[model samples]
Target: MGRYILKRVGYMFLTLLIITTITFFLMHSIPGDPLAHMAKNLPEQVKQNYYKKYGLDEPVFVQYGKFLKNIVTEGNLGESLRYPGRSVTDTVLENSKVSGRIGFQAVSIGIVIGITLGVIAALFRNKWPDYLVMFIAILGITVPTFIIAALFQYLLTVKFEILPTTGWGSFKHTILPTIALAFTPIATYARYMRSNVLEVSNQDYILTAQAKGVSQFNIVIKHILRNAILPAITILGPQIAGIFTGSFVIEKIFGIPGLGSYYITSINDRDYTMIIGTTIFYAAIFVVAQLLTDILYGIVDPRIRVSNKDQ
Candidate 1:
């Protein structure tokens, strides 16, 4: 298990390095200067001086080298163009709180509701409850998140005035956006869990347990749910990463101050430092999530550890 974990961590580091390199070069490759968009009023001589001061006048490779070195040694993501003297790190930290909070609530709500509905639906197959759960799950998958977000904003916020329309304030502000973001995940989890449960419940061991006069509830709790939920656990890593990334749209629609909003603003303003910094933060989260998922697999199922050793 330790060796497997080490291997996974090593792979994650390599992957992150590759992603960082690609992202850095690609962002630089885009036409027009980062300062061009910002310093429209500055004279050409002043603009050139600014470029020289920032080492932007240097060769692309040299600039990349400096950028990489700054990241490694000083942890500097460069200064923001929109807000001079402020570091990109500071901006991300300030804004990320809103997105993080919303993502957390959405994912939490999604996992609980999705898993429960899925289990109940599978357990009561062909019944009214099963049908109702299936219908909701299908709706979640079919509806786009943006549309759901818009409708919730319109109906719950604008029409009824039951919730606030925008900004992060009371819990009331979060209700609509959270539901919209969580709805798709709820649908996805329900379907995945239902399939897994249906498969596990019919396995030979399950049949044997039933034949041995095991209580129905115990069979489900001790055997079915345990095996069935394993696959769902694997999905959690990507799901978490996705929730953070997906907040871009949700934040914009709801006028929340978050990393998503910061990213969009940075891109429009051609704020290179802010863009790269946020991208790195996001990439790191994704890498860490993947590593956690692998470790969780071994912890959840001893069979995985045994299999790894044999391999």
Candidate 2:
């Protein structure tokens, strides 16, 4: 198990290196200078000084090398070109709190609601409850999150004045975004889990348990649920990480501070450091999440863990 984890971590670093290299050159290849905002109508000497200050005067390869070194050795992401002296690491960490919190709530809500709906639908297959679950799942999948957000803002806030339409720092404000974000995930898990449970129900063990007169609830909680939920766990791991870095659109529409806003702004301002820093940070999160997911597979299924160990 330890060896497998180390191997996965090694692969994660390799993937991150590739992503960094690709992202770095591609960003530079775009037809704009990071200092363009500073360079507009500026004197030549001042522009040159600015270039020197940010190391833009250095060759691209040299800058890339130093960029890798700073992150790998000094554990630094340097300064934010947009904020001027604010460390990229600090900026992201501070802003990520809101994003992380929202993501946690969203994913939690998604799993609980989705699993419950799915299990109910599966257990009551072809019944009214099944129809209702399927209806909700289909609706969530069809609707875009923003539309959901807008509708929530309007109905809950505009019409009834039950919830705030915008802003953060309060549970009331979190309601709209969390629901909007969680709905799709709810739909996704419901569909997948419903199918998985139906299939698992047909398994021989399930039949044996039912024939042995085990209570329906015990069979479901012990026999059916454990195996049925494995697939959801596998997919949910990376999604948990993804939801954190990817609420950019949601955050913007609702005016929440997060890495997403910084990322979009950095591109527009051509703040190269901030752009690369955030990209790398997000990539790292994604890679680690995947690694953890793989590790979790071993825990969930000892058969899988034993097979990998033998290899």
Candidate 3:
């Protein structure tokens, strides 16, 4: 397990290196200079001086080397062109708090509600409850999150005056956004869990348990749910990570001050430092999530341990 973890971490570092290199060159290759976007009113001579001061006048490779060196030694993400002396790392960290909070809430709600509904639906297959849950799941997958958010904003906020339309403040402000983000994941989880449960419940072991006159509830909980939930756990890593990154659109629409909103603004303003900083942050989160998922697989199945030993 320790060796596996070390190997995974090594791969994560290599992935980050590749991402950083690509982001560096791509940002540099864009048509307009970051300085030009920021200092539009400045005279050409002044702008050239600014470029030279920032080493933007240097060869791309030289600039990339300096960028990499700054990251390695100073732990700096460089200064933001949009905010002059401000460090991009600081900006992203500040905003990431909000995004992280929303993502946590949404994913928690998704997993809990989704898994419950799925389990229930599987247990009571073809019943009214199952049909109702399936219908809702279908809607979740079909509707875009933004559309649901917008509709809720208009109906719940605009007409009913029941919820806040935008901005982050109290719990009320978070409810609509969280629901919008969670609905799709809930749907996905429900469907996946339902299928897995149905399949696992029908296996020979379940029949043997039944033949042994094991209590129905215990069989469902101890046998069916444990074995069935493995796939859902595997999907959780990417799903949670995706929610954080994909929140960019939702954050913008809702006027929430989050990493997603910051990323969008940084891209629009061509803030190279912030862009790369956020990208690296996102990549790191994805790597960690994937690692966690692998660990979870071992926890869910003792067979995995036996297989590892055999190998």
Candidate 4:
């Protein structure tokens, strides 16, 4: 297990390196310059000074080498081109708190409600409950998140004044964005869970348990749930990474300060350091999530643990 984890971490670093390199080159290749906002009326000498300040006066390869060295020696992600003194690392850390809060709420709500709906639907297959779950899942999958956000703002805030339409810093402010973000994930987990439960129900162990006069609740809680939940856990890692980054559109519509807003702004402004930094941060989160998911697979299923140990 230790070896496996180390190997995965090694791969994660290699992946991040590749992503950083690619993002760096591609961002530079774009037509606009990071200094466009300030370069319009500046004299030649001042522009050169700005270039020197950002190390843009050097060759791209030289800049890349120094960037790598800084990362290796000091963990520096460079300063923001647009925001003056702010380092990219600090920016990500500070803004991620808001995004993380919404993501945690969304993920918790998604898993609980989605799993419960799935279980209920599976227990009452072909009944109205099953149909209702299907209908909701379909709607969630079909609707775009932005549209959902807009509709939520209109209905919940505009029509009834049930929740605040926009802003941050309070639980009431989080409600709309959290629910909007959770909608698709809830549908996703429900569909996956419902399928897994139905499949597990047909397994021979489930039949034996049922035939042995086990209580329905016990059969579900112990036998059905454990086996059925594996697939959901498998997809959860990437979903978590994506959700925690938050949706840029959702943030814009709701006026919540989140990492996504910074990320999008960085791209639009061609803030190279911020762009590369946030991308690497996102990739790291995804890689870590994937590693955790693999570890959890072994914990959840002894068969997986055994196979991994043998490998």
Go through the candidates in order and give each one's C-alpha lDDT: 0.88, 0.87, 0.88, 0.89
> Which residue pairs collide, candidate 4?
none
Cα lDDT for residue 166, candidate 3: 94
- What's the lDDT for residue 150 in model 3? 93
lDDT for 248 (candidate 4): 79
Q: Give the TM-score of candidate 1.
A: 0.94
Backbone clash count, each prediction separately: 0, 0, 0, 0
| Candidate 2: worst-modelled 10 consecutive residues by lDDT | 237-246
Q: Give the per-residue lDDT digits (tens) of candidate 4, residues 236-265.
A: 888888786657789999998999999999
List model 2 lDDT by residue over 1-311, tens digit each: 88888998899999999999998888878887778876778999988988898888888899889889998998788898777889998888888788878888999999899999999999999999999999999989898778888888889989999987778878877878888889878988998889999999999999999999999999999988889988988777667876876588899888887778888898888887888888888888888888888888889888888888797
Can you tell me which runs of candidate 3 are displaced by over 4 Å? 43-45, 309-311
lDDT at 134, model 3? 99
RMSD to native for every prediction? 1.6, 1.3, 1.7, 1.4
Candidate 3 residue-wise lDDT at 251:
92
For model 2, the local distance difference test gives 0.87
Model 1: per-residue lDDT, tens digit, 1-311? 88888899899889877887898899889998888766779898998888887788899899889988898898788888678888887777777787888888998999999999999999999999899999999889898788899998999878989888998888888888899989988998999999999999889999999999999999989999889989998889888889899888888889888899889888888887788899998998888998998888888899999988876
Candidate 4's clash total is: 0
Error of 1 at 230 (Å): 1.5
Which lDDT tens digits does candidate 3 get at residues 1-311?
66666777899889888999998888888897688756689898999888887788899999899988998898788888788788888887888888888899999999999999999999999999999999999989999889988988899999999988898889898888898899988999999999999999889999999999999999989999999999999889898898998798899889998998778888888888889899989988998899888878877887876676565
